[model samples]
Target: MKTYCFLFLIALSITQVNAETSIAILDFELNDLTLKPRTAAEINRTASIKPLLEKELKNAGYRIISIDLAMQQKANSGFGYLFDHNDVAAELGRTAGADYVLIGRLHKPSFLFAYIMGHLIRAKDGQLIGNYISETKGGDEKLTLKGVESIADKIDKDLDNRYTPPPPKHTTLH
Candidate 1:
């Protein structure tokens, strides 16, 4: 009975330690567009990149807060907020109850290519955890999704590097 109880406690502790990190991803700001007469479809396609990024982060064992919720919080806060502003990002993280915040911009150098740059920020103190930049070539939809995925992969690797636990020490019998 005691052994079983000990095993249960160990399992509970392990589950707590392995809890998924919560993150909130903001919309990617658009910049330097070369597309002539941006259509509604192109704008919508560009906006959809946030969800792809969230899905990738979720697959990487992160809990994602909804972008809508984050935006609403920003609107309620009554400030001309910027994602690069640490205080604003941190406040959004707190409002959304996220452990970290991901914010960045998308640049379209031409009609056929898109570039994305992202920054991962710690919520508690608003310190920059890491940054990633990636580019993809194609139409708006394809390029935006591909660029976001590449950035997500970079962020996933960064999280893995930061959060992976070290191996337990071994002791040999003397």
Candidate 2:
């Protein structure tokens, strides 16, 4: 019985250690609240956030899975549909064989500032892990990139906290 229990424990630990968390990052949608027409720079800035975020998350040891563009558009159904529907996002992530899905929005409430908002959702169960936000004071590429980095940092922290294995117990030798 003792040997059986020990073997079971070892197997469980090995399973935990071997499990890799995979994520799909959808292109961030732009929510321009400002009355001014969206400029080429703002549009370009919004487009840049996803790749930077994917790179950051990949460096953090997550498996970055690509969601098919046609499928994503199909899942989106309409403008802002996928961003508003995390369940739909999760379904898309599941289709891509990802453990998590990151849906983001660059919300420009004014010309002076924008908020980078991300929703992390578990694909298996469609539960939201959290909403992470970072504020950029300017519309330049540098600041917007910084905002994406900030959101990625927050996500790493949250996921690490949630999934990190407990420290192995130290047995003392007499």
Candidate 3:
């Protein structure tokens, strides 16, 4: 009983931390392929993108904000339309009041692979901020997350830069 109580306490603390460092996850975009996504296996394969994205973001220390919360908090969810990264981040920040929002898109479909991209933007200003795009081949799940991690890492480093602005520019007459 004591051990169980300790575990529960630990889980609760982690949950609190996640809640504090909240991030909104906007919906992913999917383009229609030339042919229908047929076969149960193909359908399942096609569906793995979301799970992989969520896992990767979580692993990268981002507290994921689910669609449900986004809808409930913002009201009227997204109209199946994902805005640009900067717009998404600002809108979600106004809604969920999060520090950042990640907008993802998966387009131009092909067989045995999924090509996706993600962009992180600062909610305060509509800037490109950071971006990550990847094409995973041979149906490898690890590659999907690896791509995501690469992007996430890039965003992390950029965030650090944001706090420390670049040195003043010098324009001397030649």
- Highest TM-score against the true fold, candidate: 2
* Candidate 3: tens digits of C-alpha lDDT, residues 122-166: 656656666777776645555555555555555556653211222
Residue-level lDDT of model 1, residues 52-163, one tens digit each, is: 8887777667899765654745444432245457667866777778988887766668877667877888888888888788887765565566676678767877675332
55, model 3: CA deviation in Å? Answer: 3.5
Q: Extract clashing residue pairs from model 3.
A: none
List the pairs of residues colliding in candidate 1. Answer: none
* Predictions in order: lDDT: 0.72, 0.85, 0.58
Give the best candidate by lDDT: 2
**Each model's TM-score, in the order given?**
0.73, 0.84, 0.58
* Higher-TM-score candidate of 1 and 3: 1
Off by over 4 Å in 3: 1-22, 37-47, 67-80, 160-174
After superposition on all CA atoms, how large is the RMSD of candidate 2?
A: 9.3
Model 2 lDDT, residue 10, Cα: 100
**Better model by TM-score, 1 or 2?**
2
How would you order the candidates by lDDT, starting with the best? 2, 1, 3
- Order of models, best TM-score first: 2, 1, 3
